[model samples]
Target: MTRVAVVQSCTGIDPAANADALTAALGRAADGGAAIAFTPEMTGLLDRDRARAAACIVGEDEDRVLATAREVAARHGLWVQIGSLALRAEDGARSVNRGFLIDGAGAIRARYDKLHLFDVDLPGGESWRESSSYLAGERAVVAETPAGRLGMTICYDLRFPDLYRALSDAGATILAVPAAFTVPTGEAHWHVLLRARAIEAGAWVIAAAQSGRHADGRTTYGRSLVVDPWGEVVLDMGEGEGVGFAEIDAARIDEVRARVPALRHRRPIPRVEIAA
Candidate 1:
C-alpha cells in the first residue's frame, strides 16, 4: 500500500503566503509518513480579478510556490503533485493553469496544463470567464511514479468522462483531480461526479480541494476526497483547511475490475439511421 496525503487550503491572493501554507502542510504529511503529497488547484494564488491575478502571476521558473514545493518534496523524500499553478503564458494575453508532478529528488517528472476552462455564469450573479485569461491545453498527461501510474487533471476536467476513460485505457491506475470548485456546484455535484469517475474507470481518485472564502471573495467547497475503485470514499476532509491521508493499494484496482470487467466489455455503439 502506498500512502498519500491530500491538502485542503484556503488560498489567498498572495503567492508567498500560499507557498508558506503549502510547505507547512507538506511537513505535516511527511511527519505522517506519506509517500506522496497532493495540493489543490491554484495552489500558488487564488484571485478572481484578471488584471490583479495577471500582475501577480510569474513564469514557472520564478514562481516561489513551485520552488518551495520542490524543496519540500526533496527534503521529505516524497513525490509531490503541485496541483495547478497559474503561470504567465508565452502569448502574454493569458496564463496557463498547469499541474506539475515532481519526483522525490525535486525534479519535475511531468506537466499537465488544464484542458477545460470554467466559464459559467452562476445563479447568484457570480460569473467566471476562465478561458478569457487562460489558454486550454491540448494533451492529456500520465506519469509513472513509485506509487503507480497517475493521470493528471485539474478543476473543470472532472466533468468530462472521456478524458478519464482515455487515461484508464492508457494504463493509469490512479487519477489526480485537484480542484477549486465553487461551493454551489460542489455541494450539488462534487461527490457524485468524483465517485462516478472512480467507478467507471476502475481507478483510485484523489481530489485535493480549496475550501472556504478566498481573498477574492470566492467561496469553494472543501471536501478533499480519496475514492477507491469500488466507489467507496476512503477519506473525506470536510469543509476545512487541513491534510488528509489515505492508502492506495494497486491490487484493489485489479480486484474491482475482475468482478465487473466493464472496461474490457466496452464496444462501440452502432450508428442508427432515422427517417428524415
Candidate 2:
C-alpha cells in the first residue's frame, strides 16, 4: 500500500505564509510515512481581484512555489503534487491553473492544466467568471508514480466527469482533484460527486482542498478526502485546515474492476434530439 497525504489549507495574500504552512504540513506527512503529498488549488496564493492576480503571475522557471515544492519532494524522497499555481500567460493579462507532479529527486514528472473555467451564478448573488481572468488548458496529463499511474486535475475540473473518465482510460489508478471549491457548491455536490467519480472510474480519488476564508473574502469548502475504489471514504477532514492521510492499495483497482467491469462495459452514446 502506498500512503498519500492531503493538505487542507486557507490561503491568503502572503506567498511566504502559504509556503510555510505547506512545508510544515509536508513535515507532518513525512512523519506519518506518506509516500506522496498533495496540496490544494492555488497553493501558493489566492486572490479575488482579476487584475491583481494577473499582475502577480510568475514565469514557470522563476515560480517560487514550484521550486520550493520540488525541493521539499526531494528532501523527503516522496512524490509531491502541487495544485494549480497562477502562471504567467502569453497575453500578459491572464493566468493558467497549472498542476505539477515532482519526483523524489526533485525533477518534474508531469503537469496538467485546469481545462474548465468556473463561470456560473449561484444563490445569494454569488457569481464567479473564472474565464474572465484565466485561460483554460487543453491537454490531459497522467504520471507514473511509486503508488501507481496518477492523474492530474485542478478546481472546477471535478464537475466534468468526462475528464475523469479520460484520465482513467489513460491508465490513472489514482485521480487527484485538487480544488478551492466554494461552500455552497461544496456542501451540496462535493462528497457525492467525488464518490461518483471514484466509483465510475474504479480508481482511488485524492482531493486536497482549500478551506475557510481568504484574504479576499472568499470562503472555501475544505473537506479534504481520500476515497477508495469502492467509493469508501477512507480519510475525511470536515471543514477545517489540516492534513489528512490514507493508505492506497493498488490491488483494490483490480479488485473493483474485476467485480464490476464497468470500464469494459461502456457503450457508444446514441444520437439524441436537442432543442434548437
Candidate 3:
C-alpha cells in the first residue's frame, strides 16, 4: 500500500500567509510517513476580488507559491501535487487555473490546466463567471508520481467524465482531483461523482480539497476523499482543515479492472442520423 496525504485548507487572500500554511501541512504529511501530498485548488491565493488578486497572480515562472512548494517538496523528500493555482495568462489580461505535479527532488513532472469553467447562476442567488476571468485549457494531462501514474483534473473538471475516460484509457492508475468547490454543489454531488468516476475508470481516486470559509468570504464544501477502484470510500476528511492520510493499494486497481474490464470494452460511438 502506497501512502498518500491530502491537505485540506482554507486559503486566504495573502499569498505569503497561504504559503506558510501549506509548508506546515507538508511537514506534517512527511512526518506522518506520506510519500506524496495533495493540496486543494487555489493553494496559492484565493481572492474573489480580481483587482486585488492581480498583484499576486503572476506568470508560472515567477509564482512565489509554486516556488515555495517546490522548495518544500525537495527538502522534505516528498512528492507534492498542487491542485491548482491562479496564474496570469500569456496575454497578461486573463488568468489560468493550473495544477502541477512535483517530484520528490523538486522537478516538475506535469502541469494540468483546468479545462472546465464554472459559469452558472445558482438558485440561491449564487453566481460565478469563471470564463470571464480565466481562459479554458484544451488538453488533458497525466503524469508519473510516487503513488502511480497520476491523471490530473481540477475542481469543475470533476463534472466532466470524458476527461477521466481519456486519462484512464491512457493508462492512468490513479486519478487526482484537486478542487475548491462551493458549499451547495459540493454537498449535492461530491461523494457520488467521485465514487462513480472511480468505478468507471477502475482506478483509485484521490481528491484533496479546500475546506471551510476563506478570507474572500466564500465557503467551500470540504470533504477530501479517497476512493478505491471498487468504489469504496477509503478515507473522507469531513468539513475540516488539515492533512489526512490514506493507503493506495496498487494491486486493487488490477483486481477491479480484471473483473470489470470496462476500458477494454469501450467502443467508438457513431454519429446519429435523423429520418424525415
Candidate 4:
C-alpha cells in the first residue's frame, strides 16, 4: 500500500500567497508520511481577472509555483504532482493548462497539457470561454508515479470518459484529476464521474480539489476524494482546506481487473450512421 496526500486549497491571486499555501500543505503531507502529494488545479494562482492573472502567468521555466514545488519536493524528498498551472504558451498565443509530475529528487518526470478546455455557458449565467485564453492539448499522457502509473487530466477533462478509457488501455493504474470545480457541477457530477472512471478502468482515481471562497470571489466545490479500483470511496476531504491522506493498494488493481476485465473486453465500435 502506498500512502498519498491530497491537498485542498482556496488559492488566491497572488502567486506568493498561493506558494505559501502549497508549501504549508506539502509540509503537512510530508510530516504525515505521504510518499507523494497531489494538489488541486491552478494551485499557483486562481485569479479570474484575465488582465491581473496575466502578470503572474508566465512560461513554465519562469513559473513561481513550479519553482516552489520543485524546491519543496527536493527538500522533503517527496514526489509531488501539481494538478495544473496556467502557463504562457511558448508560441506567445493562448496559454496552456499544464500539469507536472515531479520526482522525489525534484526532477520533472512528465508534463501533460490539459486536453479539454472548459468552454461552457451554465444556467446561472456563469460562462467560461477557456479556449479564448488557453489552448487544448492533443494527446493523452500517462507516467510512472509512487502510487502507480498515473493518467493526468484537469477539471473539465473529467466529463469525457473516452480519455480515461484511452489512458486505461495505455496501462495507467491510477488516474489523477486535479480540479477547480464550480459548486453546482461538483455537487452534481464530481463524485459519480470519478467513481465511474475508477470502475471502468479498474484503477485508482485520486482527485484534489479547490474549495471555498477565493480571492477572486469564486466559490469551488471542495471534496477532494480517493476512489479505489472497486469504485469504493476511500477518502473524501469535504470542504476543508488541508492535507488529507489515503492508502493506495496496488493489489486492488490486480484483484479488480481479475474479477472484471473491462479493459480487455473493450471493442471499437464503427461510426454511427443516422437513419434517413
Candidate 3's displacement at residue 130, Å, is 0.6
Over the stretch 1-276, how does candidate 1's per-residue lDDT look in tens digits? 999999999999999899899889999999999999999999999998887887889888899999999999999898999889999887776799999999999999999999999999999898999888889999999999877999999989999999999899899999999999998899999999999999999999999999998899989999999999999999999998999999999999999999989999977668988979
TM-score, prediction 3: 0.98
User: Which regions of candidate 2 deviate over 4 angstroms?
Assistant: 90-93, 273-276
Report the C-alpha displacement of residue 132, candidate 2, in angstroms: 0.9
Error of 1 at 64 (Å): 0.6
**TM-score of candidate 1 relative to the true fold:** 0.97
The segments of candidate 1 whose C-alpha lies over 4 angstroms from its true place after superposition are 269-276
Candidate 2's residue-wise lDDT over 1-276, tens digit each? 988889999988777788788788888888889998999999988998766765566878877778888888889887888987888775665678889998889899898878999999999998998888788999999899888899898878888999998899898999999999999999999999999999999999999999998998999999998999989999889988888888999899999999999999887678997979
lDDT of 3: 0.93
Q: For candidate 4, lDDT tens digit of each residue in 1-276?
A: 999999999999999989988889999999999999999999998988999998989998999889999999999999999999999998987799999999999999999999989988887889888888999998999999989999999999999999999999999999999999998899899999999999999999999999999989889999999999999999999996989999999999999999998788899978999999
Which parts of model 4 have CA positions greater than 4 angstroms off? none
lDDT of each: 0.94, 0.88, 0.93, 0.94
Candidate 3 lDDT, 1-276, residue by residue in tens = 889999999999998999999899999999999999999989999998878988899998998889989999999999999999999988898999999999899989898889999999987888999998999998999888878999999998899999999999998999999998899999899999999999999999999999998899899999999999999999999997999999999999999999999889999867988888
